[model samples]
Target chain A: MRALVARGLPVDFTWCEGEARARALSEATGAVGRRLDLTDRAALQGFLRAVVDEGAPDVVLHCAAVSQARGLQDLTDDDWDRAVEVNGRSAFALCRALGPAMGARGGGDIVLVGALDRGQTLPLPVHFAATQGMLSAMTMALGKALGPVGVRVNMVALGPLGEGLSRALPASLVEDYRAFSALRRLGTAEEVARVLAWLALENTFMTGRVVTANGGI
Target chain B: MTGRLEGTRCLVTGGSRGLGRELCLAFAREGARVAFTFRRREADAEDTTLRLRALGCEPQCFQGDVADGAHAQAVVGALTRAWGGLDVLVNNAGVQHVVPLALLEEPDWDLMLNTCLKGPYLFSRAALRGMIRARKGTILNVGVFSSERIVEAPAHYAAAKAGLRGLTDALAREVGRHGVRVNMLSPGLLDVGLGRMLMPHRVEEYRAQAALGRTGTAEEVARMAVFLVSDENTFMTGARVTPDGGL
Candidate 1:
């Protein structure tokens, strides 16, 4: 929200798991923030309808994902379902709902935000990497399916950053990530957000691509 | 000289028909003690069994859902008890639905993900215990090449197969030190199983795009699959081998 607003783009809506955080984001970025459970299909459809009614946005940036570090033996069906629903299925829903509308109106962009660990040998949960893979492939398929309609879909895969899920990782793991990168340092959220903004706003003739911002990892 | 998979104990999921059945026949011919899983395909399973028997190899067929953890565990346990240990596993069962995203429903998405992605995860998790213990095993996941290319395919199918690719990479890295090799085989536009469902013009389009000027066959892909899981596959893991005729 802050990144788009900083680019002089009006932020229409934002969603999170917590009502308080949603309200804080709304206040901070002047975008309508709502608490949304992505696992609820009805709620997601309603939200999509509301957004479409508000005039199909020029750019749809999907950055929402749920991940947990669990070993294969410890991961349950529920864990798998949660990650797939929030990380994989929700992104598809967003694209399916907003893509045709944007395409019909001449052109638009849809940028999916993913983690670099999807292609790495990280010790992250299988579900996390799997959902990231799903998102990446969906971006490619949608790019081809919607391109004729003038909607360009791409993905921005972020490396270990100093914010969000990286902070939740173990200190040792974080240090390893820092060492694994060519820059020898973790990236900032702003850096990733800038990449997302560029893909969503400025880029043309580049569809169905995964632009990695992983500090050369 | 002995067969490539001589004395090997292998299990293939969804081996009743399509590429799975072809893989089973290939493995059996290579002297593997083959066991396969089928879901509600008694006739197909019987045919596969008869063919394997004619090849002079006894094949075991288990009927169950690949996505069920308990069933996966039970299948692995049976194989382990019967053959002492399982040397190879092929996650080859999958279903395809070609609806557009606008018409795709939750059930379709779940069905695809459950079969193509979670089934592999469940079976791999179940089999990994024995593989890690024995310090020797190979897992070959069947994937689709269309996921990596700009072809007309359902998002759900692409997502599921791509997710399997991710699982293959991560699991390979996790267990490589344990002497287990994991790889994915992505075949493109074959003339069997789901590929037979494509329109004639689409098939012609795919063939024209291929460097080989033709689509691939399941038997040709099965040959590659045999080599990947055989002793010949030493020193290769965390890799994706595409037998898609250069598509």
Candidate 2:
């Protein structure tokens, strides 16, 4: 994407990854990276307002989340709210809020992250599936509605990404995870980031769509 | 960014129109040798090929009806033979009969099922032979929103897309050990040639109910498809992407 910007496309970005990372991204791409905790409604809206004020962003990419692999009973309402708020709700809010500007401008793109959890259930992490299922619905409805405005919506579904929350799993689960992936291995951040970049930057015609970037499955 | 499919050979179905045409152009831009199938429009195929060739990419078009068996075999076989080695098969040829599920016609049901479901199966069955031989290949099936949502489609279309999703997962596992990756590229409301017809309203009606308040384009979906087929996505399978703007 930086390369595309360098090639002279008017590029802008607002990252919620955190202050330092967001700042680095802003510097690398010359994009306005606003570091707002996506879960904080007030902060998110305010920050996005400021971003819209500064200059309307034509594309909005929701890439923030909190993950935990607790058992079913171990899951709590707080976790649900947090997951919903952070992982999925933030996207809903951003689109709900900032979509008008892009539409008014006559065009833009919004891409979210999804998972296979909606269809296939895993061992203990059901919340991930639940929110993702809602997220999928939102993607579909939004696509139909927003397509007329030239504001495209889409999602890149994900599989397990790392050894962080996953390494602590049972050996059997780990084996299952490995075998479940078409590549039979773990994915890397560069790999995931590349996907994010593609959904945001290239292939301009696809919207209200879901493309699984989960290796080969 | 490195153009992972730089020299890989690819074949995309429904290349005579919309998302298929966009995929052909994008792949050619990325330095891939492409062989895309067109059902009957030799003119559209030529236009696509002309555009691809203008990009300094090798492109060829074949004629075949995805709904038929012999044509599918000949087309898939021809592509595999032309390149001497095929690396990616994008099974994307599909048709939709969008109506209130309650009012969908029986013939429309068959059209939906045969085009979306049967096409992928036939193409995959044929492509898998060469892929397993090479021990490396990618199957990117273009699916629909019906797989995840019960949008107003004939039961057949929805069921077929749902089945396609399942096929992607199961096939991903079945061929994982063979070094083959199976994936589905499911687009929601899109701005491609078909989307313009699917929901002809001005779209505000749809937006009022949508979470994202908009539709997407074929290029964006194509980009996602390309990334999935790229080398970077090395550990994901049985995944579904809802590129619908936050619906």
Best model number under lDDT: 1
TM, every model: 0.55, 0.72
Between which residue pairs do clashes occur in model 1? none
Candidate 2 residue-wise lDDT, A2-87, digit = tens: 54465466666555545786677777877654456777789988977876677667777776656577778888998888888887
Model 1 per-residue lDDT at A51: 83
CAPRI quality of model 2 = acceptable
Q: What DockQ number belongs to candidate 2?
A: 0.33
List runs of model 1 lying over 4 Å from the truth. A1-217
Clashes per prediction? 0, 51
- RMSD of every prediction: 18.1, 5.4
Q: Model 2 reproduces what portion of true contacts?
A: 0.59
Model 1's DockQ score: 0.01
- The fraction of reference A/B contacts recovered in model 1 reads 0.00
* Per-chain TM-score, chain A, candidate 2: 0.82
Per-residue lDDT over A1-217 for candidate 1, one digit per residue giving the tens place of the 0 to 100 score:
7878876778876566567877887888788677678999999999998888878888998888888777799889999999999999999999899988887688788889888535567777788889998988887688777766767788877777887877767788888865654345677877667557655765544456665666544
Question: Model 2, residue A205: what's the lDDT?
Answer: 49
